[model samples]
Target: MGKGGKACDASTQNRAAWLHGVNDLRIQPYPLPPLGPTDVRVRMKAVGICGSDVHYLKTMSCGDYKVKEPMVIGHECAGIIEEVGSEITSLVPGDRVALEPGQGCWRCDRCKEGSYNLCPDMEFFATPPIHGSLADQIVHPGNLCFKLPDNVSLEEGAMCEPLSVGVYGCRRAKVGAETTVLIIGAGPIGLVTLLAARAFGAPRIVVADVDDHRLSVAKTLGADQVVKVSFNKEDVASEVEEIKKAMRKGIDVTLDCAGFEKTVSTAFGATRNGGKVCLIGMGHCNMNVPLTPAASREVDVLGVFRYKNTWPQCIEFISSGKIDVKPLITHRFGFSQEEVVEAFETSARGGNAIKVMFNL
Candidate 1:
């Protein structure tokens, strides 16, 4: 709320939305760390609320990570460089960039193998103990910040963070012009996957979800067909048939954006023999599915963690107009205490809200 008169603090002029505990989010002063030799000081411009951010706010946890202490909550963010370290020349002050949140420990074996996303020692922003990029200013590694193209806005630059997941999933599934795709969840991730698959030259893509509005959004986002699905486990067989009919061709790959028992089973039933079922969503950590028959049919189940080396590609995809993330931004709010609470509540009470943004 304090925007004009000596806001934030006398020493630290940065304010952030922090998650203290369950349903306890507050706007408070956040002190920025000194810039490192290879780091750049960035003034944040646009940040998007993610499902994980909502989870950490409402429940104080997402997956095995718990919010035991206060932490700034936002990862999908874009900012303008305010200052650059002496060691950096690739980026300069006044450059707009999208920040890749995760910084892998270069000493890890996974980093050496170029699979940095799997590094156990990754320091991901807004993830548990790691404070995120919701503040007015942040100091991040210059290498992790990719310069946004002239055609890309700050909001679209923020979209690249979540869009990276879809691109990485498609890469794992090997989507191509001859491949047919079926995405089994019309949430934000599912819709992004549909866009990524299309950009990867998928000839056909079908999307299914329990919500009709999300299905409609998927259809409008270039999905060849959208089917209304059910969450009930017993209805999976019938739902699979419906999904098959919607596709009208055997699914070459199934991206199960909803990691539920029912959704995974439906994917197994709908995909053709030798197809790949890529599990991207983390709806349920422990789900029971029929794996024996799927294995017998040569359907391989692939797993993907966070993305690696995908920020530049996502930026290009947006800059080239191959993927349109503007329609996905359903709501926007300013960086104020009251607006922060409302923005988070709007995201948690999801209906038609696909992506929520914050203009700092």
Candidate 2:
């Protein structure tokens, strides 16, 4: 990699990647493009294996979005700046940074209003045609790249992607010092939501998951209470009742990171009157929500797309030691292209893994 006033020999051919179909990913050589004036070239160091990556690998799609053609498959990544564009002033060679994969048209009203995550023309990485950061190097707009503090490692820097989602969820839900928060899934996002809620000063936090291992992780992460749900149970209402009994008087806010019908129902039933439900998971695009009853109780249902303007706060939270994400990284792999594929497979199967990360 080029850095520190020295240029390493450029590869004769760049290593490009493609996802041919479900369960089929291939890496091949291709030509690298020269940096644009507003671009920064980075050598990827660590990329976390996300659930969306697993879904695309196993089914070649996520919800309605499908991988119709070969596409690169990663977005959560941290890297070292190998080259900088002419107009870039805040970064240079050798700077360690985290990449924000979503690129939106700056002319849109959403972008101008600081809600670029909702931009209709946003081109996000690893979401079909748009290439991601799984390869050896990537060229991205300089502004989307976030500089890391001296105390944060590259692996931790990569976690800022998911952490931003948690931060955004908390913001949307308006979790506060007296709020009783219930997180409906104990996956990375759910657990991170718990951490964010705690950092936001929420008084009580309860987490639920079908996986015992994940619940254990949530307990370790300081969840006030943990509920284990059975997927095979015919009546999830009883399970919801049990969780409510443990939490006492239901919760003030519910965050559904599972995105399943059962979990959504549970959230609707368990959330106290006038509470909020934040939907963060993408399990089903169109599931039946208990809107009538929720409305009668004055519940506000909120939806979260990607995060906007949250990376800086997440980075600051991690750097200040208010939130610890090191324990969330349950597994790690080398940066080899093959290892990246394996990590995604393991994450998809969901066995004894919490957060799988790739070290480049």
Candidate 3:
């Protein structure tokens, strides 16, 4: 960690990567508002490029969230705490932490029930109207930031954001020591899910992906089997058979990290009777799959929104050596206009680049 700075004063210069419009990103000055009693000013260090970030960059929208105004464009971030608010006691200056991006309205029923990720009024960073952390500095709620243990690097700290998705997905699917798991897609989310499933003590895990590089990465990450599939839906049946054979056992759970129609179909076909299929991808918002047969077989489908109450466990996983996310970070960039463009391009093009990060 670097030396901490003072609070946002007249001398504190803040700049952010702002998405002005579709394919339009600019590095410009961002004025900081006064820090509230529970806020902490974080000196941004490492921020990763998520699929949704590139989606918003290229098309100006992701799902229903549209970039109506110039908003900062990053969320998977880790930083050093430079200034703490008056009422804060959990963290202090020089603390390295991973930030949980979404902020829910405390008054919502969802928040009261501990399912704040479902809150309708949630203001997540880099989601539509909310500004993100791809800046030199930003003030955020201290409670949202989880301190990094000594063993975790800043980049690995940033990875806790994606790792949370895997942890939550595994939790939803109920993967455990007795469960045989199959993971569809070998992208970042899929890889993290593989790690989470392994850490959760899944007896056997198989990963399927369309890319050889991704599958190879999965194999190196300790997947029992890595099966390759084509983009064509025609390969679904044969691919599922291959996956079943590779597992050599009934798959109790299947995580469709790639939400294409074929992937979902394969997940249904491969999962054992009375098994579970968890949908963790956003590749397709709507798809027609063999639902009736899956329902007849009692293959329950599960859905995952962002994540809820996962950061602490994610940090514990990284620090405990139960999950190693450093290998998934395949690229890095500095905070420059050219590097920003290159970073997003590498991530959006997505072949070999798994996790693209920025070192501010």
Candidate 4:
């Protein structure tokens, strides 16, 4: 039994989840299990929708990841602790918290090696067969749930999930004071990457995107230069060349936040010899990059899955005022079950929306 209820039973609880095999999601009653001795019950306050969420909503799948059944579709979330397990010590009821969605089997070598993000036995929320935070409440491990500082809002805490990705990408690319970085996308992730890069002391930051509005937001977020690209442009190579020339000797690191063939090509072309290129977006499964040229130029191509060992640093960054995520949240929704579907729908069709947050 937890603080809010007697015990987990076969009884149904009202929850709003996105069921697959259909295009739209709905609110309905679902069953919740009782909290275990190591689990903490959380009353979900805010959940942010990622681009992956939209992909699931529109296509019901992302690459090889598919939804086989009804699943709650929110991984970026923050909440208040409603109940603590018998064995939990560091957290208790009413504590504002941020959730690290992936729970890896601690006994595995990958988990022991501090790369839990690569743990084969991990179960991540919002992933297929693993229901996520779109519900009213959820049970998670106390260790995976981090306590929020007094100054950080539940919305900023919810944003840590995606921001962690940016931090991980920067860490992988080794971005620093001498790095001249080119970020090839102006979406949420790209913008966050820009912020993280700036925080990492990158000397120059260049951002490109098809959307002018998103590019403007990137500029506001601290991008040194913003380039607007069009799919119909006849000479993308020339435009990229001009941008590179304008950026002075070429970029030390190039990140493809827009995972398309064209953007990948631009990323490869934008980097200097012996530089690094990282692909952070999941727009395309197989991209035909300029591998031969990259090999000749000694360009290091890197990939990022989810982040590991980054939550603590991200939390500290936010707490210390190095990263301000408040402006990233352009829209907010209430915790009422009625607004769940609408919130997902709005996020699924992003235009003016940067980050959509739910308040409980």
Q: Model 2's lDDT to the true fold?
A: 0.84
Pick the winner on lDDT between candidates 1 and 2.
1
Where model 4 places Cα greater than 4 Å from the true spot, the runs are 1-11, 232-234, 336-338
Overall local distance difference test of candidate 4 = 0.83
The Cα error of candidate 2 at residue 255, in Å, is 0.4
Candidate 2 worst ten-residue window by lDDT: 1-10
Report the C-alpha lDDT of model 2 over 1-360, residue by residue, as the tens digit. 111122335574556455778778777653345687888989889888888888888888887677876677789999999999999999999999999989889889998998899998788888765777777787788999999999988988999999989999999999899899999999899989999999999888989899888998899899999998976545678987888887886599999998888788888888999999999987776777678989999999999997998888988999999999999888898855687677777787787787898887
lDDT of 3 by residue, 106-137 (tens): 89889999999999988888887788889899
The best candidate in terms of TM-score: 1
Q: Against the unseen true structure, what C-alpha lDDT does each candidate score?
A: 0.90, 0.84, 0.90, 0.83
Model 1, 115-177: lDDT tens per residue?
999999888998867888988988899999999989999999999998999999999999999
True lDDT of residue 78, candidate 3 = 98
Arrange candidates by TM-score, descending. Answer: 1, 3, 2, 4
Candidate 4 clashes between residue pairs 3 or more apart in a chain or in different chains: none
